[model samples]
Target: MVGCDDQMERLLEDLTQYSGSSRERKFIRIIGMRGIGKTTLAKKVYNKADIRSHFDFRAWAIASSQHNVKKILISLLRSPKGDTFYIEDEADLADMVQKSLKGKRYLIVLDDIWSTKAWDDMRLCFSSENNGSRILLTTYNSEVACSVGTENLSL
Candidate 1:
């Protein structure tokens, strides 16, 4: 770890281990109550890491208590993911996001999700044939993480 802060140090370690060694496509939820630094920690790892160059592409989606699938897909497709840019409809956006992710390893941050459906709808986009992609999901619900999979890159 490169910081004097112990919490930051621990976060650094966890991010390094997960991104470097975890081969399977993963969903990590930083579960905590409000103001517990879940988003802060995930942001630190996202901003101050060498993982970007390690992966083929990096994208971020800002989820809310109420979110539409097209909005999320549009945001995730903004980065260099090789996906066609059409987000007027939910089906079109989802298909483009999935098609663009083929053969590429991606690091996607699904921040501030509130339900399992968010993961369910978007899981197909991250589940690549190559199997080297990763999705970092930050939420306040443990059940959301567990519902997706127990094997998570949790904060």
Candidate 2:
């Protein structure tokens, strides 16, 4: 943690600024090896400061070695967001998630992603909304991080 505390803090600040910006979409992907605290950092950031004073809605999904977009989406949807649950397929779940996230500055965190396909499918749920909605994705693959970010992530 000490290795990049300042840098992480600065990045968090920049994201906070973007959260309030009346501009484009803001998507952030945080990647690192398993047990290296990517999930921990994402949780702390989402609950404490990252979503503070900015995000109108917040959702998190845990994608382990399995890829069940429907179940994950149902979990987040049925949370405090007041969304309903269903046994729909991935496409339907994705549509619900997208609708629930629309027009709101949301912080959608997908933790412990194991496959690129899961990210690809879930990405359909998020839209720019012009409210600077942010996506904080955590994975162990450098490619996944790079695919969703302008630069690679390491810790």
Candidate with best lDDT: 2
Best-matching candidate per TM-score: 2
Given candidate 2, what's the lDDT at residue 114?
A: 78
lDDT of 2 by residue, 1-155 (tens): 54667646755764576434365667777777788878877776777753566778888888777878787788668765566665657777778778888888877778887777877867777887677667777889876776676423455
Residue-wise lDDT of candidate 1 within 1-155, one digit each (tens)?
Answer: 23426765654554445555556665556777866677777777777647766767778888878877888998888855445564478888788777777777777888888888877877776664545666778888777878776444443
Separately for all candidates shown, the number of backbone clashes (residues 3 or more apart, or on different chains) is 0, 0
Segments of candidate 1 deviating more than 4 angstroms: 1-22, 80-86, 152-155
TM-score of each: 0.79, 0.84
Candidate 2 lDDT score at position 150:
48
What are the lDDT scores of the predictions, listed in order?
A: 0.71, 0.73
Off by over 4 Å in 2: 1-4, 19-22, 81-84, 151-153
